[model samples]
Target: MSEDWTRLSAAIRTARKARGWTQHQLAEKAGIGFSTVQRLEGGAPFTRRPPSLDRIERALGWQLGSADAVLAGGDPEPTGSVDAAAPREAGDIGAPPAKRLPRRIEHELASGEVLDTEVLQLGNSRVRMIIVATFEPGDGDDQEAVAEDLEAWTRVQHQLRNMTPSEGNP
Candidate 1:
């Protein structure tokens, strides 16, 4: 099906302006090149990647696939019902502020175990994550076993990040 690049471009521009962000700022937040965002906003013909579009959509606080929907002549759905026209506060950039980065984040596994991780932003478009600790429910932990499990889990996350869209996700 043909896509309306014009519509997608306008929608992206509107969202970026609504957030009081320049093309460079959006590019940084989306982890994409400045030219990509500029070309997209200018309605210039260019090859599109799913990951790039997904990042741009996420950076704009739009739901995943919002860009594709807009290109198809439909409205982009806002993530968490955010109003694009809402006024932005001073220094309230679209991306999370550096000081607001989580020092620690915990996730509970379906098996009732807990995984602790720390996520660090190394620089633009580069992030490092460390598994701090893992807790098994109601049992003494083995240090060796915990290390192995964390290593295996990290490898899986790496695989997922590198997988193409057609591969889908487990």
Candidate 2:
């Protein structure tokens, strides 16, 4: 079953344009890089990261699996909107639960740089963390440092998961 990249791209592009959004705007709303939106709109290829596609689907107000349906020569299904203030619970029929905002923290370093972190709990025992570093003006190349810092945290998390009770660490 080959996927129709052209069909998917056209659907996404048409939806985005109908919303009067630029590629950059869609990328920001989808929490992805701008080039990703370009690639998708250009029918370059499907993303290796499946979560990126999921994010794009949600950002475009499409129901889950709408992208796959589109690639399979079907139209995207629009998601029914749920009020953020509406009282809802898990397993509710019809509409999904309202989205929750992420917890954010910001710290200013002595060098006048700022680090912002957002923590979102997807479900029980599953959390996603995003870190953004804002260097002072004229500091053009600190993203690698931020990525290294995030990698270090990932390593620490794995190490902690591997610890046993006999190690005398909780």
Candidate 3:
């Protein structure tokens, strides 16, 4: 086993005991079998199949590197920032911060122009002309408000029969 396993398992046992829970309790909490905890504490090979790391973490109120993983040599963290590992600064140990790079955002807007289109539907011998209604924004407002309105005004075209409607009658 890796040297880290012994250290990690000891850490697990320490954390569990600090909470005043028994091996069975820790097993139940970590979602692993009772023997798993016992083996880990005794530095023996794990007797139970591995459980979900997420569940185990939740049970221990910790973020992985637990007893079973240590005993079974199941957890092997890479030599860099582990994904979702809590971040740290210089002179700070372990993973780094969770701050992500700023995302590029773009705002697009369409003017108050009613768009019309023609569509042909197959299987029913139906031809359709579609009209989409829109409204231009008032002057003197920030582009954001107009952009919001434009976003809200993008409606689907109505399905219409061939040719424009004249007077009444279907």
Candidate 4:
């Protein structure tokens, strides 16, 4: 393995152990396979590369960083400790974003789950669906729903390619 891979491999192993997950558990949670986790730890080869990072981040809820932060009272905190919601168990968040969720989300946003949705027709003849997602500061694990939505969108796009806009079959 390359030096970067070696170091990252060790770090992933450490984080997984720190979270008290067996490789199989982590794999299942990340929506990946057991062999992927083993190869990642061994650094045998980063065959899946970038997507692997997404899976790992999804399984761990948060990824370690190297930034430094200062608390309100002037205490310098270590980097990689961006724990916005400190939950009791590892990855026990109510719901988390997808492993491949777009990180460049704009607009000041918050995380939530859909409790209700209502469709409204606007004055400008545009219709919008207002979904109410119940939320608190997230514990940040469990990306299954987001993953499912993403997969659904992908299928929608594929279906769209076979249709013409004039066909009323939308």
Candidate 5:
């Protein structure tokens, strides 16, 4: 096996173990398939569009460029010793913190309402909204009730869409 591959695989294994996470947990946290985690931990050849090293780094909470260095045959310093109290470098003073993607927001329509909405932020500036409403079964099937429910759902969807900022705006 190539030295770089072996080093990278070992680093991944060590980092996962340090967090007391199983392969399945790591895969879930990384938003990747369990089998992919297995292959990576098993040191299988990284073929067929392997997951991005950046994704794995984010999932593992390692400092940026740590995985890249391992894959490039360089030893990376452990991330646990980062000196938060240290002064920032001159060039990095104004650098913004990295944004974590794929956030989720959930809220209810009213204090006691059975309707709830969840917003999932997909990467690359895309988002999906899901609305859920619950109702107790009626005495019998009621067409009018069904139609009312549909109308309420449609109105909620429209309101949510309008609340979202337009693409043209910042």
Candidate 6:
């Protein structure tokens, strides 16, 4: 088991170096902590639960079972899921396929109060809208409640986005 771990560690180090990625860069790309990457690459023993193999594979642009193969001292194989030949920045590895943007729309009512609406957009589609705040004189609505509701709604939208298929036909 130790030998397998050692081989896996070496393979990880080699793949990271081949891509000109530092430990910190790998951590960021893999969505893992810097110390996790350090510990793995440092061969700190397989005594504890390791980082997610899926995350490491995604970060290194390797096939799904590549980690297992490397651990068994075999060659890594391409999954052909992502274009390995294409140049990718560290920021692009674990980033969401769609970009998110929050847009604020405010209007001054006839009563001199401002009605503020915030819309969260994922890529070109608007995913969520919240009445962020009502800036009115003598208004005492709990702003914290509004924030909490918005947060919960945002989480739901994110989950929906993940569950939905990216390809329209598929």
Q: How much lDDT does each candidate structure score?
A: 0.66, 0.63, 0.47, 0.49, 0.59, 0.62
* Per-residue accuracy of model 5 over 59-167 as CA lDDT, tens digit each: 6766656766777787665556322223334454322223443222122323234544546443345445445565555678589987887698778777765674558
Q: Order of candidates by lDDT, top first?
A: 1, 2, 6, 5, 4, 3
Ranking by TM-score: 2, 1, 6, 5, 4, 3
Model 5 earns a TM-score of 0.42
- RMSD in Å for candidate 2, one decimal? 17.9
Among these predicted structures, which one has the highest TM-score? Answer: 2
The lDDT leader among the candidates is 1
Q: List runs of model 3 lying over 4 Å from the truth.
A: 1-3, 45-49, 52-54, 65-170
TM-score of 1: 0.47
List the candidates' TM-scores in order: 0.47, 0.49, 0.33, 0.39, 0.42, 0.45
| Model 4, global lDDT | 0.49
C-alpha lDDT of residue 161 in model 1? 50
- What digit string (tens of lDDT, one per residue) describes model 1 on residues 1-170? 77888889999999889888888777777656778788889886556533467667767888867887898889998887433343334344334312222212322333355565555443343445444445565467678777778788788667645644343321
* Candidate 6 per-residue C-alpha lDDT over 113-152 given as tens digits, one digit per residue, 9 for 90 to 100: 5444455445555344343434445456587865775687
Q: Note the residue pairs that clash in candidate 1.
A: none
| lDDT for predicted candidate 2 compared with the true structure | 0.63
Local error of candidate 3 at residue 45 (angstroms): 5.9
Worst 10 residues of 4 by lDDT: 64-73
